[model samples]
Target: MLYVPFAILVAALLFGVPIAFSLTLAGAFGLWITLGDVGQVVEVVGTTVFSSVADYTLSTVPLFILMAFLASQSGVARELFAALSSWTSNIRGGLAVATVGATGMFGALSGASTAAAAVMSQVAVPNMRSHGYADEVAAGAVAVGATTAILIPPSIALVIYGLMTETSLGDLLIAGILPGVLLAVLLAATILIWVRINPTLAPETYPSSWSERVASLRGVWPSATLILLMLSLLYSGIATPTEVGAIGAVSAMALGFALRRLTWQGVMIAVHQTLRASAMIFLIFIAAKIFGYYLSLSQIPQMLVTWVGHLAVNRWFIIVGIIAGYFVLSMFMDELPLMVITLPLTFPIIVSLGFDPVWFGVLTMMMIAMGLVFPPVGMVAFVVSASGGVALSKVYKGTLFLILSIFAATALLMVFPEIALYLPALVRGREF
Candidate 1:
């Protein structure tokens, strides 16, 4: 059954089928072959599809996606970049540094790497170009900065990981905060270092007047308020992560309306985008559930776990092996699809080794973060380059520094797990 499904999925993907369709077709084929009855396959497919998407926890996806779309459409992205640039414009490379900082904040609200890249590229790239900053430097900053979305709180990847792993969403969300912030700081520092060494790459801009700087804060307050509301609700246990997402959507729409920026067309577009994205995600999720069920029935997870446990190698070596596998897989796959396919295989192994699943989720997300800026297939890089009308090579060059920064941060987290664990522990009163 497993072999059949894998073959079908691969064949369909190779033929350029959409991922969701390929997954569903593959699962249907697997069920048909295993049951030896077409009727039974139909029944299993129908039942699994219904049960998989009937999850209440999944409601957060569309709501958060909608909120992000609305915020991006309402001119909030430009406001955020402007505010950060005003504060960080004076020093050499400060504009690039501020782009990373702004991207981090934008990532918190949006949680979509492409959206972050598009937003920042539109706002920051032009300004950097006008300032005589190198095209590659500006494009690269936007590309790498956009990837911050993957590790930040409200991340769609984290939410999906929590749902799939059956880990606490709040715990995973909280776990992301520290690592995400640390990565941002490190990336900013990297930009500063590079600018100091090669000042020609990034020209200095005059700092805005204090009054201008202070006034720019008004445009950014909506995003800040939204973040505060989200964090407070989740931290205080006042709402589940799903509820927080729904509240965020409603709040964002309200803000757009109050700002007189929420046109009927914008609302329609947001709803349409949300629906399309939600449908695609749910379909993949349902298909993955059937695939996972088939794998369990075959005892693949247990067999792999038993095999790993039987090995006499050091546990840290095994952990490193698993992380390395994820890093490689991420280069070829989008984070969501990769997680959906591989988490079942890896989760049992990690748990069998006495590792915390929540911590591992954070680590896994960081690995995905690195993949988002990697060359050729990096989705964020593609988005940034296309948005800025810059070459992919330029984007890759700029991301080199940010990638090193992410690796440094990844090493810190790996050496001291507490960076990812501490906040969740303080909030939840137990290690997850």
Candidate 2:
């Protein structure tokens, strides 16, 4: 019976209905089929959507979005890349290495992969190409490395996951630190190795003097300060995610004003973009509530978890299956709405298996990050191609090895849960 509604949801999605409307219509049908009253469906959806979207914690979404947009318009991306490049441009493939580093650093502040990809594409790709790097490697590095945004602190993906699962947002955000850094290093190593093997990939190098390296630090302090502040607030339990985001937003605006980068027009543009992104996320939040309500009524979620608990298979296989399932679903769908609709089903099953929610949150964040580079519907890849004016085929081709790197990082996480748990546990002083 639950399959009926799930099918309708998929069909609605396939037929080009918006995700919010698709979830709403499908959940309404599910409620009608199960409860036999249209009014009851309306009641559940109206009440749940209202209550859930009104959450104070969820307010972090727009604040972070605003912070990122303002930071973007304020020249943070360009400055950070220039700073990193000045320090690294001399060695073979050094500019590409700087691209990975800059993308990772910028992604931390923005916490949105698409924005990071587009910005890096504009900032890094052209520079790499002029330095004689191949299109696939340049575009691919931006596409894959931008995924770090989805795992770093203040990530929109982690925010949605935390809100839906009733997990501690602070713990989830902090848990992402080690895994994010590990992926960045893996990506930087990949560039070094690939460029070494196929030296043609990067022909020109611009090495800098030690004095220039010291001067380059001038461009990095805004990002450095914001990262430190956000992490300190969250890790020390001094501010909730929303407060941290508020402070970040205010600081970004102040920096823009100080640096003379925020024109009145830029502020307007940033606010407008923030509203657009926030509206999309909030709509999905409301629809997820409606869908989640229907799932709860069906008893199917509980049954699914119970069935998984009773399975004779190995527990680790279940974990792999969930991660792999996300990878497959990502190829056909947008990540946020897909995650919203599915967490109700997967969360319980994962909890019943006795995994730490915070650790699972990190794994889930990694899987979501992987989706940004997955083929077919890889949004980050598309953004890179468009922004860099490169062929889509070349971008996808480039993402292949980077995606392998993502998988390798995922394997590390699975083999060592402590990698994600250690920082959060140490911060909170709890044994995992």
Candidate 3:
């Protein structure tokens, strides 16, 4: 019964068990079966839990998470959206375009996709609706736009991927830059086209005066400064991911206070939220590590790698199959669970095929982006629908259309790996 552990894991998931518990239970069971010793399983569990989150680098996770929560509670989204919309207000369906821009900008601060979705739904959807935009358009823009948070720098997803694969965390974060911007551009373009095809979708456009546009820029300095600081530190190699995260969190809080948006109560809330989110992520990390030990004992990843190597088909064909599997699995699972569960199995196969880990990390993130907005169980779609007061069906329809832009962005990355690699390459003076 080499597959019994997986069967148990699937059953646990199907029964609505928490992912951390499901992984821990399934992994402990697998270790017991393979080692045939109860004492050994307990020992393994003890060691894995401690070692999993003990890395100095993993410290970045909580810090970035804090920065995100602080930014969320500090009224950053409102001013950020206003500033972006002022510039884009002349175009047809420009508010939706501005929503995407605002989301991406906010992404540099907040790496969590659901947080981005929730914040933008509150900030952008009401404004779009007041301007005569359709529910689908508004909902779709927020859902799709939030996906960029997972790709931008300080992304918790990228951080976890780097930890799992032993890739450089700096490179992984930097690698997401161009690709994230590309997705944002493509998403904005898609909204523009959608409005052009159906002018009724957004009947009126608000064109801002030059003075208003000029004044709007004043409101965005905090967000712009924070992002520039993150990029400069990262690009110049002046700080590690952990240091960057620490600086970002402190900067976000300081700016919040300076702008008179953050209060003592707000700081308490941000800290409380940060602790909860970090604990959850670290719990999963520990569980996934234990589960990975079980997989090693079972030799599943090794066996899969050998089997795939013997296939005579073109390598791209194999990549296609893996990507299709990711798309299907991600439709029902959240991105972190999907990454933690599948990376152990798929990463080995990807490495055996001579694929670049950093490139694959970005590709996996693109798939995660699609899953965030795809139908059936798109988490971001649910967040947007719930927060924006839009119908779930309308949000799903909007995401379905917006998902095409993700496909286009993915296709572009596949054609030119440098899009994700260029910035990362410059980080270390190494060529990819």
lDDT of 1 by residue, 1-432 (tens): 458788888888789887778877877777666677888878877898889888899888888898898887787878888898889888888888888888888888898787898889988999899998998789878877877788887899999998898998998988888998898888888888888888899866678899999999998899899988988888888899999999999998899999887887998898998899889899889988887766776677899999998998999999998888888878767888889888988998998899988899999988887888887688788888888888888888888766888899999999999998898898878753
Clashes of each: 0, 1, 0
Tens-digit lDDT string for candidate 3 (1-432):
779989999999999999999999999999999999999999999998889988889899999999998998888899999999999989899999999999998988899899989988999999999999999999999999999999999789999999988999989999999999999999999999998999999899789999999999988998999999999999999999899999999999999998899998999999999999999999999999999999999999999999999999988999989988888888898889999999999999999999889999999999988988888998889899899999999999889988889999999998899999899888778885
lDDT at residue 348 of model 2 (Cα atoms)? 94
Native-referenced Cα lDDT, model 1: 0.85
Of the candidates shown, which would achieve the greatest TM-score relative to the real structure?
A: 3
TM-score to native of every candidate shown: 0.96, 0.98, 0.99
Which regions of candidate 2 are displaced past 4 Å?
none
For candidate 2, report its TM-score: 0.98
Clashing pairs in 1: none
Candidate with better lDDT, 1 vs 2: 2
Model 1 misplaced stretches (Cα beyond 4 Å): none
lDDT rank, highest first?
3, 2, 1
**Predicted structure 2: lDDT:** 0.88
Query: Which TM-score value belongs to model 3?
Result: 0.99
Best by lDDT: 3
